[model samples]
Structures are given as C-alpha cells and as structure tokens.
Target: MGTPTDEDDGVAVALRDAVRTLTLDSPHNRNALSSRLVTRLYEELDRAEADPGTRAVLLTHTGNTFCAGADLSEASARDAPTDAPLGLAGLLRTLVAFPKPVVARVTGHVRAGGTGLLAACDISVAGPGATFAFTEARIGVAPAVISMPVLPRTDPRAVARYYLTGERFDAREAARIGLVTCAADDPDEALAPVLDGLRRGSPQGLAASKQLVTREVLAAFDRDTDTLAELSARLFASDEAREGMTAFLERREPEWAVRQTPAR
Candidate 1:
C-alpha cells in the first residue's frame, strides 16, 4: 500500500500492482460530497488517468458510511453556491468516460449523490454491511442529477420505488437491482481476482472494452446533465428545500411533514 496523502486532502491514493485505489478519507462528514472533497477527487483521478501504470481505479472510503451524499451543512449555508449538481455531474461523467476501468468497493451506507458515484463505476462490489438509498426526495429535491448515471444502469421499477420513497435497501438488493455488480460477505477477498484480472489486462484492451459498455451512460450525460443540473439548482434554492434541509440538519421534521390534528 502506498503512503496516504495529507489527511486534510480528503482523498488518499494507494497503488498496489497496477491498481490505483482512491479512498475517500473525509469521515468528518461521512465522506459527503463537499466542494473540497470533490475537487480533490478530480485531481487524484486525473493523476490516475495520466499514469500509464494504472490499469484500474478502485474507489472506497475510510468511514462506516461510504458516502452520505451532499454536504448538507455546506448546502444549507447562507452563502452556499448552487453549482453543486453541476460539479457532481462532471465527476460522474468523468467516471463513466474514464479510459481505465473504474471499480467501487462499497462496505457502508450510500445515499443520494453517493449512489450516483456507485452507478458511474464500471463494476462495484458491495459488502454485507453496505446499504443504499436514494434519499433526495426526502429532502425536498428530486434525484435528477444522479438520475443521469443511475437510470441507465438500474431497473426502472427499482429506481422509481427508491427515488420516490427514499427507502434504504441492503447490498443484495443493490446487486439484484443492478446498482452493484455483486454483493459479498468478504468484499476484499472477492475483489482480489477481479483486480488481478484487471492488472493483467492490456491497457488498450481495457480502455476499448470500457468504452464499449459506457456509451449509453455517456449519452445520458450528454442528453440530460445540463437540464438535470439546472433542475437541481432550482430545487435546492426553493423554500421547501430550505425547510427540508434545515429540518434535516436540526434533526426535526419539516413543517410540511408534521401531522395536524383534526379540529374537535
């Protein structure tokens, strides 16, 4: 394992054989997609892409929650920018279009935009401890931006249920619904053969093969990213979203969610 980068960097790169494992290290916020973390991830990805020795990239996390989605604290700030969805869209596109195979090792909870990250990967292995949800609707926003990557890979019925209900599901369901490639009790052991195969693959063959499978996903990005990102920005800026986000941060139900008693 390679030496980790500065802890503040939010991402750590470890190289073993030809695989570059990029670990999401920002456990402070459950590896949420903050602006800083996203920027750092882009930088690390660029390095891996430019490195000829890197045959594949493995994405994982340091904490129990693989990723909890967007940084609600940042999103709820008074001066928060509304371009988060645009940045997230670009990152997802990068993963989908990456020349080398991008794989995910998810062993914890994933929510909202984090699910997009998993969907964008060419292959993902989820451990027994992994759980996933499309929780955007619960926060008063549609899973619009993530839908670009997710809808192409997941079952339409499963997508509808999760996106609309924001309900959590286990790793097996994730695999069954096409969200993850496989679910395993020992993810690392299961990943060993996959990584070995990737390491032995020719660079040209790997890149070409990835391109074949990613065309549909890339097309979705081209067709819907702009519109979806704009929709996300608009939704995040609305009054209902403000109330929802605030309520979430405050650990209380939003006013709209509170039940009213009938007058006697």
Candidate 2:
C-alpha cells in the first residue's frame, strides 16, 4: 500500500490493493473547502480513477466536523476573481462519473459544501452524531453544485424543502431521506463490514455496476447548467450571503432577515 499527498496539499490519498482512501486533513478549518483543497482533491481523485489497482475509494475527514463546507475565509480573501474552477461541482461530477465505487465515512456535522460531499459518494456511512445541512441559503448562496448529485440520494420534494430552508438534519433523518446508507455507533467498525462485502466483488463487476447506476440517475434529470451558473453567480453576489458569512466569522447569528433566506 502507498499513500501520497497531492500537490494541492489538503487531501491525502492512500492505496491498498483494490481500495483507496482519501482523507480531508485541514483540521484547523474543520476540513473546510478551500480552493487549494478542492484542486488537490480533484487531482487525487483522478489518480485513483486511473490507477488500475484501485477498485473502490473511501472518502473520510479529520476532526469532529467532517466538512464545514467552503472556506468563507478563502473566498473573502479573493478579490475580483473570475473563472475560478468550481470545486464542489467538479468533484461531484467526478464522483458521479467514476466507474469504481466511492464510499463516504462521515463522522460529524457536514454543512453546506460538506453535505454535498456526502451526497456525491456511492454509499455513505455516518457516525451516530453526524448531522447534515444545506446551509448555502442562509449565506445567500445556492446549493447548486452539490444539488446535482444530492438529488439522487433523497426525495426531490424533501431535498427541495430542506435545501431551500437550510435546516440541519441528523443522521437518522439523512438515512430516512436516503441520503445515508446507514448510521453507525463506530464508523470504522461499520465500514469494515461494508468494505468486506465490496471486497468479494470482482473489480470489473463493481465498476460496471457503478457505471450503470450513475447513468440511471443522470437519465432522470434534465440539468439546467445555465440556471445553476446564474444561481451561483447570484449567491456570491448577494447581500444575504455576505451577511451570513460575516456572522459565521464572528460566531454570531446573522440578522433574522438573512437567516430566512435559504442558502443551499
């Protein structure tokens, strides 16, 4: 087995036999999505997909909070940036298109972009305390990127409601909505049994199954790429998003009016 840290510097990739493990390691920011992190993750994912020895990939994170979503700090630091690659969207697309299985082992609050990360995986196993939220609306952003893959995991109506509302949901609720495959008291233990099952399948069979499932889900939706682009543009430009981000940085409640807006 070999583990390599890609150039982007936020993700660590380890390969063992047919399994690859990718860990989000920006604990200082609770594994928040920074441009650097996103770029690195994409690179590593590409590597895993191309590697003939890899059949499955496990996505995990450090700290109690799995992923706090996009690093607002990073966004705030940027000035007049145009045409930056949309990280979350690209990652989700890669996962959905991946021929091999991708598993998520979630163990904390997965908010905003974090929730999207979970939704992108082929299967998700969350710890008992894991909570999820589509929080973009609160910050004046849309869950446009993550929504692409998330739609397949849960009821459309529920996704619409929750995503629009920006409310937090526990693991049980996630499973109920089909966003999670199962919840576990011990994530590592829970994953062992699932990995064992995956190990029984031939790599080619697993890859083919993954491809079929992805195609089936994609066939159901008529994605409006233009609409998503517009929404994301508006989200980044909205006053509510600015206010929500300010509040989060200050560790306080955003003004009530801002809170009412759905961020996801």
Question: How accurate locally, in lDDT, is each candidate?
Answer: 0.91, 0.77
- Candidate 2's residue-wise lDDT over 124-180, tens digit each? 999888998898877767787666667766888888888888888888888888888
**Candidate 1, superposed: residue stretches over 4 Å from native:** 1-7, 258-264
Task: Assess the local accuracy of residue 151 in candidate 1 as a C-alpha lDDT between 0 and 100.
Answer: 92
lDDT per residue, candidate 1, 39-132, as tens digits?
9989989999999988999999988999999999998887889789999999999999999999999999999989998999999999999999
Q: Quick one: best TM-score, which candidate?
A: 1
Worst lDDT run of 10 residues, candidate 2, spans 76-85
Superposed Cα deviation of residue 260, candidate 1 (Å): 10
Q: Any idea what lDDT model 1 has?
A: 0.91
Clashes of each: 0, 8
Q: Given candidate 1, what's the lDDT at residue 226?
A: 89
Candidate 1, after superposition: displacement of residue 165 in Å? 0.8
